[model samples]
Target: MRNLLLKLSPFFLLLALFYHPVNAQNDSIKILSYNIWNGFDWGKDLDRKNKMTEWLKEVDADVIGFQELNDFTPEKLDAWAKEFGHEYSILLKEDGYPIGITSKQPIQLKTKMLGGLWHGMLHVKTYGIDFIVVHLSPHDWAFRRKEAEIISDYTQKSVLMEENSKLMVLGDFNSQSPFDVNYDAQNTFSLKRKQLSDSLRRAKNGPDAYQNLRFGSIDYSVISKFLSLPLIDVVQKKQADHNKKSFPTLVLGNNLSKSEFEKNQQRIDYILVSPNLENQLIHAEIINQGTPDILSDHYPVQATFKYIPGK
Candidate 1:
């Protein structure tokens, strides 16, 4: 089917869509998505943020996508991010599931993807791409489809008409991908096809491939393509929400085995991203500052990106 589609869809293929650099000079930017496990721990909040600080110093990650802001407002988030040298932070208006965006550079509010129950999509225009850092719920695939549909309509003109406009929809896409589950009993559509759009599937090497998060070997840490607006994921680095190897064996227990870790553990965080500035790709991955005691249960994912590329 893939071969047939590749042949038939070649003409319809988004060949002209990968916007060429209209200008000889180009600027670069980096954006990151993370679930920071933020909460009101009262007196120990400073120490709680230590892992975040350590990761920022090491990874040099500029823009961050954060979930679980607890009760922190945008102002409070900014103040807290500042401890790690992050200059700006924006928390969405969602109740408990607030998502935050932090950057070393100034973040300008562009627009928002208003539909869907998964928090909200933060529309930010930078590096010639309309970047939307999202946090999708794991509740069900129906919500995921709604999220995709909303984004599709939002970028239809700019991204679909081969305008070279880029749109990146990334976050903790809570649901397992299509193939990750058997065919939904009621839905006749191929489980994978129903959830992720065609553009996302084609970004990588294979059709049946899913972002190899959690249970797998390290491959290219993304599903990116130059032509499409929702180009690809940044899984090319074998990245995850947090690192387990950084944990101490003693804390896990005296008698831990491979099966024990696999069953009891999971890398449940993500840092998926779209293409932008190469220099901004300083380093992206889970921050392992040793024990899980001081660190947020889920490590704060980090990446160092410059304000703009070639600056």
Candidate 2:
């Protein structure tokens, strides 16, 4: 009986070496950030939502941070998340334009700030990483700057608390990145400022709007603050050469002509990570293919990071 058991041990060892639990062999986690265009067009387009679900399943990200979840409740988002294989979800608030986080792993809400921010910030912990999802003010650069300062203060405190913290801050900034030099070279900044001025004049809020636009419409202070936190911009770092335009995608309800859209296109969505996670970053992209291009006015940004055990 002892000899027989010894012979079977080799087969058991072989099986243990060959089998792994699901993604155990893959030491990477994919994080995605997207503003789902007013909650999948205000939750009125079911077909679009279905298509988006399919797309999410295909992406197979470990976690996703969302902005502009205007009409989503926690239950509604949970149901949608299950369809795409996410078992855990959390919403910032039910009223106004809320943000959310959904993950394949369990999510623990750390912070939800709604009083001082424009759209608000939703912070959660999952897979041992901290994610702060934010949507800063869209109409005023100065307001966005203030919001960025608040976020910076919070993030700095978190970083100081732990030397090896794995943290990320990402979402629709609604402001242009200073890293995208094309905006200045192509005069896109001036064009957008002119467009803003025209709209404000039409609304008869020209003076106040002009005062807010004093910084010349294309402000870098918001993004610069995050950079100052020493967080790495994953998309900028990985896809440095590509045209990373993430906004004004071809949507169902927009009147912008092809040329107009091209001129107005900018990369507002982002996925930023702590410097500690920089070496683990394998791939980062602004998703532009297939359903994403037509599903929302803003394209999603994704970053893949290799998991380090016991970090």
Candidate 3:
């Protein structure tokens, strides 16, 4: 009878191990999204890189999504990430302006879609959460909208497959959100953008550029798609009334006048999370304080979430 009971105890232990929840304790995680301005101005100016690396370490995000990794190799990114204590890293591609993801935890590459989109999309999973990092088209509104559709379609299917999926879609969107009232009220940015678009068009197609140019200064189509996925814009969710513009920092140099800054100021970077993780968000903010412009053209965005690791 004792021998039989001993064998049954081993089976019971195995069952318990299988049924028990993994890392059930609630933990918190920090995620950062930054464009890094053409890979810290195309990897020139070592001082800037050092400063950026120090800032990254200070922020100590669990996962970071970077855009404009212009000339970085996989090993280069990995080395840079290691300086900030992130051991794992992945780059979408080698050529053009590549995007990359770095994490303290092991990152599982889920998808890498670049053919149809301008900058491309990278889907990676870490710490029991799926993160889709994107840098959409910056040149045209219609092209950006199309890119948004591709991202939304994929995310929609992912959401459908797992109702309680903990996910985040974040990066340099390069488009305005409807929720930002500042953009709606201010015509300075819109006018400037339209003028820039028209100039580019004219350059490409001679004087007949007006025929092909359609600039919706305050376009919502790109951002609205992600919102329709029911993903919460962390900035809006946290600071509903505060106007936080994420671009055109001191990268244009510290000499810009107040009016010039205002004209270029806009929120082009974002960190959007799935509804399932919305309630878990602790805080979100644009990292604009203290020489942010020197590090990159766009300020880095950080969000903290209550997470259950290995879930």
Candidate 4:
């Protein structure tokens, strides 16, 4: 019947294509976004990579978005995905660190540059859904904001064309929500501004001026842009109308030189979906569990959605 329809006409062929299901699963689907520090090599031990494999197996997500993958060859990642029971994979094959997407189901590549920005942005179609994986700028908020604008404009155009397609953008944004400023008046907001200002001055004053420099916030722009699109942030949406303190995806250790100089614990990782998929969202969370302890400075974030295969 499908072959016959294909021979009929282009219009009928389109109908025949639409009749087929877009995804394999008919029920719940799990997606995860993780920044494994410097790929799986952060700890400089093979055991760290082994632990990550075991952890991914345990999480059992159908799709995963990974960032900060250093020294990862296609063959290595392919072998890793096979261990996790995923047959499909794609990586941003380029210099410096890159991002990737791995899925249990088949996927087709859409875009890799997201308007030709730094770090990387990936677009893939799989599981009857569209996934955009990204690792935004980490050091400068201004750069991140610019990158976010590129993504926002591209997303707006893409979403308008296929309004009903389930879309998810997930990865290590290295950014935080501007709305959190409401609760960060004293600690988060003021301190970060001071630090940024000091750093700017230090740059002008030469190396000696950076002697007392400290890290500060610069991720607000990306989150703000996504929110403006009215995209549904899995965790944020779940916490709406409640005491909304976002769980920290990036955890710091006690090895810092001074307590005051320590960077604030914040959630810079996220999994956001289009507004159309809001109701399909089951739940989302940041995974920080382990027997000894989870490896990597950034925890993995997961989101579950009720599958609605494309007709």
Candidate 5:
């Protein structure tokens, strides 16, 4: 009877352990991608700046990426990030294209793989978890191909070789999803694109293999295809809105007017992560879409994720 009681004791202890509150820590991360409308030669947006501040304050994300940065100085962006209690920022003002990233935790920049025209990779890790923040060009198709080549080259030569490095290419990629089959006539949610084909063309010559993920609506598949890395999109798993269009903002202030910006529609922003990191993705969203504050002309996109344990 005592032996039976002792065996039951272990089972009950296990149950009690599950019930403990101390084990509540999550392995996921909260990430935000904002094309903060800055630098563009529009009517100076003081009101919009305040709106941006308020919006960002409400977001409460762990990592943030901002685009269209011809105006905001690195010092100013750093100051703004500081307002959010963020300790790190990487803002550039070169070319019509500048991108920046801010994080509460320190990001170890893989400087070799980052910035030139496109922000390639900002490597960061928190508590044994690893990530690489990437911002791609948001241009027409032909130009996209050129940028894609650059990014693909950088990724192959740079990130894949790193030990345990989980890559995430998240930001505006300008090109539509026509290259992907997942979207109907309206190409919105697809991870795979023509870049996948381009990457495949070079795979045979590369040291490692690759996968093209346009097979799915989520960006994880695209990262899986391009980098040959293991990962998936967690937001799609918990949500049923598979057809949700990643409606990019219409550029309203410059040569692009309100109607011009509203005319064409597609999901330009993305979050393509390593395959192993997909299951950890918890949530993602497009911020302040309907309401336009002239922060550049595009809406900000953000994602939350957890670093899964034991595969």
Candidate 6:
């Protein structure tokens, strides 16, 4: 009877650890991705920074992924994180522009791959989840696609090894979803019309414009490549209303002086997570209440997720 009891003790201990209340709440977290428009022109954004500070406190995010942080020194970023009450920070600075991550919990910086990538991509582990924050090429779709391939390959390899590790990819992709091609056709066509030179127009939609504008036709599949994996866009998949029309993160045309932008918008920023993490998604939102110029060209995107331990 004593020997049998000893064997059962091990099983019971395992159950106790698995069902502990402490472990239950450790996995739930809130994440935010914001493109602060760190530097569109060569001016300063001191007032904007203050507004951002207020915004950050309002969001109360556990983890934050920031992109287009042009000209932020390590010290400045560190201070910014501290001001927001985050205990950990990782900054990837490149040629004055920097991308970064801040977490209230401890962060284990993983291997930083794809060095020399135009904007940058950051990989880290926090709250028992792996994260890849990226700000891909904003100008070229082809380049963005290649970058996505590299990121996808890395994610796939990670999954191959762990199989069920929670992963989240968040940032400003600067591209559109392939699924929304039909909705974007009108906007693409109009943009193309304005881009044609007089000589080019005489040629009547010449091959150069067509080739250069080919990306528009495809609706920019950069995000699609990443989504092809087991990952799902938290807002897109859960928020059915936003599926039909693209929600513009970055606003363009007019309202610049007054810190506003035209109503026409584009949904380029995103937060994507593994299927398991997707199941835990509570809510996702794009924050765009403040004046555009003072707040940011791109709105901040936030998502709430709860971790599911052991699959």
Error of 2 at 272 (Å): 0.7
Model 3 clash pairs are none
Candidate 6: tens digits of C-alpha lDDT, residues 1-311: 99999989999999865442312355567899988775433237676687678768776788899887777766767788888878778887645567889887677888566564667778888877888999887545556777888888877886535866888899988777765555455444334432453336437756443232343344466777877885787877655433322334345445333222232455678898888776688888666555433467677788887645443
lDDT (10s digit) by residue, model 3, range 121-239: 99989888889999987766777888888899998886536856788999999888888756646637545656777788878988654421244346776888889887899998776
Candidate 4: tens digits of C-alpha lDDT, residues 199-310 = 7866898645532122443336678798887677887766442233323322344444333322345567889888888888888876655521346777777888888775
The segments of candidate 5 whose C-alpha lies over 4 angstroms from its true place after superposition are 1-27, 40-43, 93-95, 112-140, 178-243, 250-263, 288-296, 307-311
At residue 126, give the lDDT of candidate 4: 86
User: How far does residue 66 in candidate 3 sit from its true spot (Å)?
Assistant: 0.5
**CA shift of 260, model 6, Å:** 13
Mark the 10 consecutive residues where model 4 has the least summed lDDT.
241-250
TM-score of each: 0.57, 0.87, 0.86, 0.78, 0.64, 0.76
Candidate 3: where is the Cα deviation over 4 Å? 1-26, 187-190, 203-216, 240-242, 253-255
Give the distance in Å from residue 20's predicted Cα in candidate 5 to where it truly belongs.
Answer: 23
Model 1: residue 191 alpha-carbon error in angstroms:
16
Per-residue lDDT for 168-221 in model 1, tens only?
Answer: 555555533221122122222222332444335446646454432222221111
Overlapping backbone residue pairs in candidate 1 total 19
lDDT of 2 at 21: 30
In model 5, how large is the Cα lDDT of residue 148?
A: 65
Ranking by TM-score: 2, 3, 4, 6, 5, 1
lDDT by residue for model 5 over 65-89, one digit each (tens)?
A: 7666656676877887888767677
Where model 6 places Cα greater than 4 Å from the true spot, the runs are 1-27, 39-43, 186-190, 193-212, 215-218, 240-251, 255-264, 290-293, 307-311
CA-lDDT, candidates in order: 0.49, 0.81, 0.81, 0.71, 0.54, 0.69
Which is the leading candidate under TM-score? 2
Candidates 4 and 6: which is better by TM-score?
4
State the local distance difference test value for candidate 4.
Answer: 0.71
Worst 10 residues of 2 by lDDT: 206-215
